[model samples]
Target: MNLLVRRLFWISFAVCGTVSLVWGHDVGEGDLKVTVLAKSSDAWDDKPLPHYPTGQPEITVLKIIIPEGKKTPLHFHSVINAAVLLKGEVDVHMPAGETKKLKAGESLIEVVDKAHWGENVGQGDAEFLVFYAGEKGEKITHVLHGDETPEAVLQEANR
Candidate 1:
């Protein structure tokens, strides 16, 4: 019993130490750590957002910060992507689709072929983290149209 307990304790400690080291061990004291409230993995539901990892030149992780009531211009992701809501509520608009409200602790997988726009509907700013599986210089978004889409429902949703 004593030997088993000792082995378990050492194994747990080693696993935690390895995780801490691999996560973010090289940052200097003054380096800033930005947190995106939107699309945080911590909010993942039963099924984790799909991961389209393209083994290419490099992997890109992008973080976007949105102020309260602000919305991202319409765009589309070029590669397979996943977004996590880290801090606040985000209302996302999809072209030819409906608006979905994503709150902190929730994650969304963007449709590969659709244009998307997001707004911070919560009282505070929202943060979004996106991981793309593509080459570093690849363009993830192609703007189809601005908020001025002719769809009356979409226009009203924007407001």
Candidate 2:
């Protein structure tokens, strides 16, 4: 595991332990089923993972649900991110005409600094958790509306 992933695992472990203590339960006492869904140093498209941005490191985790038949506008992320599709399916489209269909229980190391979007291709809502590794005050996503840049989005976000 990389340093960043190790740190995140320890942090999550600490939190789980603390919560168990507070709730009068042992997190590891039950029939624990541990599984590694995905692990890679490259994006799903086989590109090498980019280096983390230098600054005060910050992590953002978001749970997004896209309703069936709904499509998100083209967007890009300036920071590194990974996601796990917890429910339903999504057809992810790249600007170069490449596409990937991610199903429930799958994971993906997302394409950073590239234009892409997703559409729900399942019978129900598509739910996923996206974890963004970035610096403090960094924008994780920038919606593209033809020729828009991340800098411009940041400027607009600050306002």
Candidate 3:
């Protein structure tokens, strides 16, 4: 009985020592960590996020790359959308003269139903991952005509 007890104690000690050695070993030179870049209770405009449209939800993800000195046409999202800047920099401009700049590794909760455009202002190409949340069969983006403004589009949508 004493022999058996001694053997069991040594076995337990060996197992625990092995575990501790493995756990304490440095896997890499630097400490791995996660950081939250952006968090918001409301959209960028400080307004509550728009409600999801009825019917089956259709979610879309897009990786867009804009070359330096390029700009998108004035457009609005009919659905809730957001984007994360993957590389370079971009400036989001609204018709009301508001502007927001985003750099690499940053995120933005895009303004919904508002006419705006994005421009790549950096020397390198700008890349972003954008997500759209909408209902099936709904149009996600609407490009504005030459004479149309955001307010006009909003009014027309309400009518």
- Judging by TM-score against the true structure, name the best candidate: 2
Clashes of each: 14, 0, 0
10 residues in a row with least lDDT, candidate 1: 37-46
How would you encode candidate 2's per-residue C-alpha lDDT over 1-159 as one tens digit per residue? 776766456435432434444345465665554555566778877898777654667778899999999988989888878888999999999877889899999988898777889999999999998878777888788888878765577677769
Candidate 3 TM-score over all chains jointly: 0.72
The candidate, 1 or 2, that scores higher on TM-score is 2
Tens-place lDDT per residue, model 1, 50-98, is 3433333334567889999899888765555567788899988866567
**Arranged by lDDT, best first:** 2, 3, 1
What is candidate 3's local distance difference test score? 0.75
Model 1 Cα shift for residue 111 (angstroms): 1.4
Off by over 4 Å in 1: 1-57, 146-159
Error of 1 at 65 (Å): 1.0
Per-candidate Cα RMSD to the true structure, in Å, reads: 12.7, 5.1, 15.8
Q: Give every collision pair in model 2.
A: none
* Weakest ten-residue segment in model 3 by summed lDDT: 8-17
- Per-residue lDDT of candidate 3, residues 1-159 (tens digit): 454345334433432334444445566534543344555546677777766655666667789999999999999888877788999999999877888998998889888888889999998999998877666887788899998876687688778
**What's the TM-score of each model vs. the native?**
0.56, 0.77, 0.72
